[model samples]
Target: MVNSVNKRGEKILIGPRLRRLRTSLGLTQTRMAEDLGISGSYLNLMERNQRAVSAKVLLRLSETYDINLSALTSGTDQQLVGELFEALRDPALGRDRVPKSEVEDVVGASPATARALVNLHQRYTELSRRLVREEGADEAASALQGTVPATDLVRDVLQRARNYFDPLDRAAEDLHTELELRRTEPLTALIARMKDHHNTVVRILPNDVMVDMLRYYDRHSGRLNLSELLPASSRRFQIAFQIGMLEQRSVIDTIVERADLPTIDAKRLLRTTLANYFAAALLMPYGPFLKAAEALRYDIDALAHRFGSSAEQVAHRLTTLSRPEARGVPMFFVRIDIAGNLSKRFSQGRFVFPRFGGVCPRWAIHEAFASPDKPLVQSVEMPDGETYLTVARRVTRSGGTSSAPSQSFAIGLGCDMTHAKRLVYSDWLSGNPMPIGPNCYLCEREACPQRAHPPLGRALAHDERARGLSQFAFAPDH
Candidate 1:
């Protein structure tokens, strides 16, 4: 579909977006204007939506910041539109429904106001949830309940930073350059580097001795031990992760310091998280990886084979392809266990994960486990109206021996509908996307047969005369 062109032949004015990008990078209006070859007053007008951004200025912004121009402007509205739709469906809104056209007009004409509306909706939803919970809690317990979940805090830290740490990316890139990680035998190179530089010998030990551990380092003996059960790709990753811990300590420490994490455990987790990211970046250098992904149409298995990495590693790396100039399709990568516990999540796209409950069972992430090792692709629409094309596969951790325990989880990689055509999996999909929700508590879908709980702010109604598909039927707010 062609984007609508303005009188100046510019494709829509994303003024709030330009302002956001400039502020995100801590750039002044004057500095941004100078960079874009425009006067400060003109830039101000553009930022306020009084003046549309020309194609030339858009090109300059894209080239200068290494940003995905389409994503900056066009991809900004789906989430807002979705949230607005959800808000309008609230019982408090009564039977008078707000039209989708009005929502679209609000998003297009004044995106800042639309964003503020979304924020207010989110706050109202959250406050309603808390109010409901507090009604049942004692004074002291209710006070304690206000503390944020550690997962929520970590998520916020990653989200606010857009899941891309420039310093870490630069460090990984520099390390890749210095080590020449894109060689015919990159794993061998990494092993040699570990041995020669870090004085750490990488050993693959059998499962019996290394029980209950995937990878462990004996600091005193200068040995990094790995389980024999691990596949070749995992073995290589463990080695590189150890290298990151040893060599990239300062970089990881600096990042953790900058995060101002709440607790020691959060710091430790962030450190490990940074190391894992560094390992992925090292294995798949951004430029070559991005090129191969585009060439292969982002076939996860193909890219994994080309890069000599695991499917999970490749999927996770895809989410990190947020470098300004060389961005890939914005994606959300999540790993959920069979029991529906989210172990890992990162999104350049705006797929919201539930903070306080299980993910909606309707999501393919949970179903992927039924056909272990097989990839299942689906087009899913959230209750609010945003759609995504998601690919999910179950990954297993070996226990070396058949009798030993193995852990399994499903990894999901998804991009918004606009980018789905680029993926090979989309060929089999047809019709509208399956309607799903972020979670039961946060979901306001009144008729979802799979809903496990009533949505926040919507009170449950007792009806002897009628039974609905959902167990927790809600009545309109009085």
Candidate 2:
């Protein structure tokens, strides 16, 4: 009873929380007071915690606002505790006033203080980030004057451009009218139709003719020389890019300019990327495709058949279901070569997977390489106890019609387990099977023998017991 009633223990920073909630609810103190059946001054005092929130007032607010009191209270308190922790991270203060756990306890018990702390902490973080970037820029610029190398120029552009498209982005928008290509899937049906309409002969050329080349464009004769080893998907992409380079050069340039991309290299890469997007768009038009996916419960094979695409294509298309009019199953899609090289990652959903290097071996994505030709769907449980539903299959990558050897790649589609029921993979979760793994960054399971690298955010402490079962015998709690 004492702990529950301890006012000091409640980390209530209610003033900011009250103000935020009032703003969110679109209410002034007078209106809020009227709603609460209290005087405006009394309402103001309550927000400041000069007046304790009575049980009756709390109940009324909960009912009136259509919110759970515990939730509103805890949310604010957690935000506050986080701010306090961030402040405490700066070891300048001699900290003996209150125990950290007690401070956390108060934050949990009291809602108001937590909200203020979070708000304050966020502001501080932003200021700190700005200061660091500004300082770094000033010092670096001063150190290297007239001789700003190409690498430095690239860094400047990347820094200013936020590492995404610039003029290229605007070009993509402008090209929508000219090329009529969706941002994700860029190719038009007309382009695909031209193959039959114009008798566009797609010849499987010898790799020896264009060694280490993906596609060669001969605009004069309208010939698309694709490496024979390229997969069907690759061949189509190469052909469409050939079209983009040949016909859609203007649109590609517009996107490059819109994104503020450094041009000398942009002409080569951006055009190809936009062309592939156009091709993908052509295969899976947003509206009809997403509708089909929802109707079919996001079945990859069904989508592939409907679009005349490969399983890998369907998985890739799953990333772009973000259109306002049409949305499909939102999942993270990845493609990895047999050598474990990450070829592509299409992720726009909530989660942020690593952008560089290899993924955790323990992840089910690696399993596709082992069982080529077999499509698999598995319910994955990460080392950190996070479970995910993953759909994986092995796909072969060819160098087109040429003798360029094809390399096998594994395509994986996954979503958080909480979102699994919405997918067509619930059936895979019912049966029990051995989990195969060795994911370095994704696995949090300390006991995993296959973990090649420690998870990015985990810390390990060396324990006296040397014969632990896991690879890194150190023990640390997240």
Candidate 3:
């Protein structure tokens, strides 16, 4: 039997748009259910595009929330297709049995697979990193040795950006004056231009509106939806992006070019990533921001208020302070959610993340979900005996901010012990080690039960669980 289907373009937008609306009203699945008289799962499926947002429900949303019909319809786009493709490209999909085309077809036609696609893609990333470690031994060795190699920095810089799209950045450095950033501050001036020139909009939507994460950018319409409740630290970063494109467009392009990304998609992502970099730089200009961070003791909130940034922004910017000549503090930064997903991550090698996933759930950042907005800091050590400091706080993301139900998620941030000392917030790290870090396979903690895969020199305990110090005993990599 032929399956009745809506246009692919329509389905994509409907899902995210429904998500945006449900978030705006601060309605949860249960809450939205009570209002729309629909089951939570059904509402979820609809918002996720597992179920087409039916005309009847759409009408109710438009009527009840006074949402524009066009906006609802506008949910359809190429982004979902891109996200799906990105997921399907995952080398881990069905352990490699499923072909990319098959995954694509299913993702385009079946909503369940679309959801599943994210997991499959994340798995792919994990596996690929493993392969990179094994095959990229030379690169890894070079990274550890602090020796510069061809194309190595290229990968790191691109990865730091998480491969997003931004068209304008460094190309305009000389033309900074053109954008009014030449004589003035790049970051501050960039923000001015974003508001006045590109029609790029920045609005701190209510905290309740966006529950889970820090920043959301709508490239189609050029809108930056920020969480109003986010610590001043992060909001400022988002504001910078809004301004950066208008001011740093040329600079962004230069970075994108020099980076020499392989795919158009990667290039696009890099553009936005660099723009974000500019934004953070503006709030905490390299030199002064570093001085304030040092003086304030890296108190993220205080620094945030000083620089008008959010915790996430402050964490990310801390990594950029590594410019050798005027380096502020050299620290690594990582962001992970309760689901154990490392959504946003960057490290200075001073703090190492697992090449894989399933971070130590015992960490305070993992617990941040229980106490939103409160920041947690801990000093920890690697199996190699390298000590580091970790800072964590719960960050929220809002789904269905338009008319459907919405939800929230939290992530963790961390770095090294020495780096922590440089941070205004390092006072918490003066004590003993904490259970903050990634899981086995990547983390060489031989004692962890969450070791989905054993670390490099570990032997399977087999029956040793009944007798020894650990089930799977690990030998040192050295």
Candidate 4:
């Protein structure tokens, strides 16, 4: 039996989790207690958090119910707490500061209610944005048309799945073995597989012919056209992605069907996203990749070279390493353009990304643009006091020409401080972490020199006589 204390030595409180599990199984406290060889009163006390769940009880619960221990102690609660913290920071709430302890209490008692509150806030935010865009449009119209964007819907779906798709990973691993990708060059092998299995001819087209497109498939001609500009890694990924579309359609469809998305556009977008996931898995099989990542201390460049992939591909793949038995470090990844527009974001842990607006300017991701191509490491602490080790670097897209320059984007990869020591970048940790928050609106940190906006729900303290380093200053009490 594993002890109730987590790795950090914090006592695990399973009250809410225990109650939820019992309710989910439709078992009464008395019945569950009898099954676990415990008294009903003791069970009630455990559910109410009046007592800590014992190691023996945990063992019995697992043995009796076939429960995974980690499921009860996972960081899902922390993720919810983070989301709720951000949601309550919205100015529209018009409420004074709600203590973080109260928020945790609510989550501990009823996580579902906390999640519903977050969802309600998200819907309200979307409707508010629509109203602004429409300029005093009818409330009914704003409410009706303010559905979540397909991209956001897809992001939520991926987040709920922890960015790992077991079906896709298994299928990709099987295909990788069948193709003997370990022994053969991946690009040539994948191209040959496309030709042999799908009867699709692969052709590399000139810059003038292909134009701006990197990869184009002509279904009528049964030909896959790749631009001459794409590097070997990208060409391989494109081919593998095409193969996923053709071969893994059923698996992808099953996953999408299970998703039960509201819009066809979202479903289509999810299909494309899943295909991309499959391509990444094909390029770097899960078991082997996890082993190699551990061995290499998650050096993105080293993994890219070893797996015949780009640095971006390798970084993105790191977020999907969430296998229960052979899991790698749980990390969050985000990609942003030079203008600070976030293009891609994923988290396999408790780190929460802002649903609306730019991230905090103090984050190291923004600093990556200054030293292009050089990786910068920083230990950052969130407003909630959670520390993370962030590694940021700039990566350029392929197909750049003298006439048209390729775009460069910053990639940010980070893991919780608890797991930071496993990363090679942790050597740069100085113990003194830079304070960051979700964004300017949600962040309450005072005197942030890089703050772009005043914190939501806080009154600005403006004085002509004296000015602080930041453009906006708020009341200390606020």
Task: Give the top-scoring candidate (lDDT).
Answer: 4
Q: Return whichever of 1 and 2 wins on lDDT.
A: 1
Report lDDT per candidate. Answer: 0.79, 0.60, 0.59, 0.86
What is the lDDT, from 0 to 100, of the residue 429 in candidate 1? 86
Candidate 4 C-alpha lDDT tens digits along 95-157? 477778889888877888999999999877755543423212345233533255677668777
Tens digits of per-residue lDDT, candidate 3, 120-210, equal 7665555445644432244653433222222333446645543222333223223343545425554455455666776767766875777
Residue 283, candidate 3: Cα error in Å is: 2.7
Which is superior by lDDT, 3 or 4? 4
lDDT of 2 by residue, 107-152 (tens): 6544556566657766654443333232125454443323333333
Give candidate 1 misplaced runs (Cα > 4 Å). Answer: 1-146
Instruction: Tell me how far the alpha carbon of residue 162 in candidate 1 is from the true structure, in angstroms, after superposition.
Output: 1.9
What C-alpha lDDT, on a 0 to 100 scale, does residue 210 get in candidate 2?
66
Off by over 4 Å in 2: 1-214, 227-235, 262-267, 382-386, 400-405, 431-445, 455-464, 475-478
Ranking by TM-score: 4, 1, 3, 2
TM-score on alpha carbons, each prediction: 0.68, 0.54, 0.57, 0.70
Q: Model 3 off-target regions past 4 Å?
A: 1-129, 134-155, 158-239, 398-415, 429-431, 435-438, 456-459, 464-478
What's the alpha carbon RMSD for model 4? 23.2
TM-score of 3: 0.57
Worst lDDT 10-window in candidate 1 = 132-141
* lDDT over C-alpha atoms for residue 32 of model 2: 93
lDDT by residue for model 1 (163-226), tens: 7777777777788888887655877888888889978888888878887888999889989899
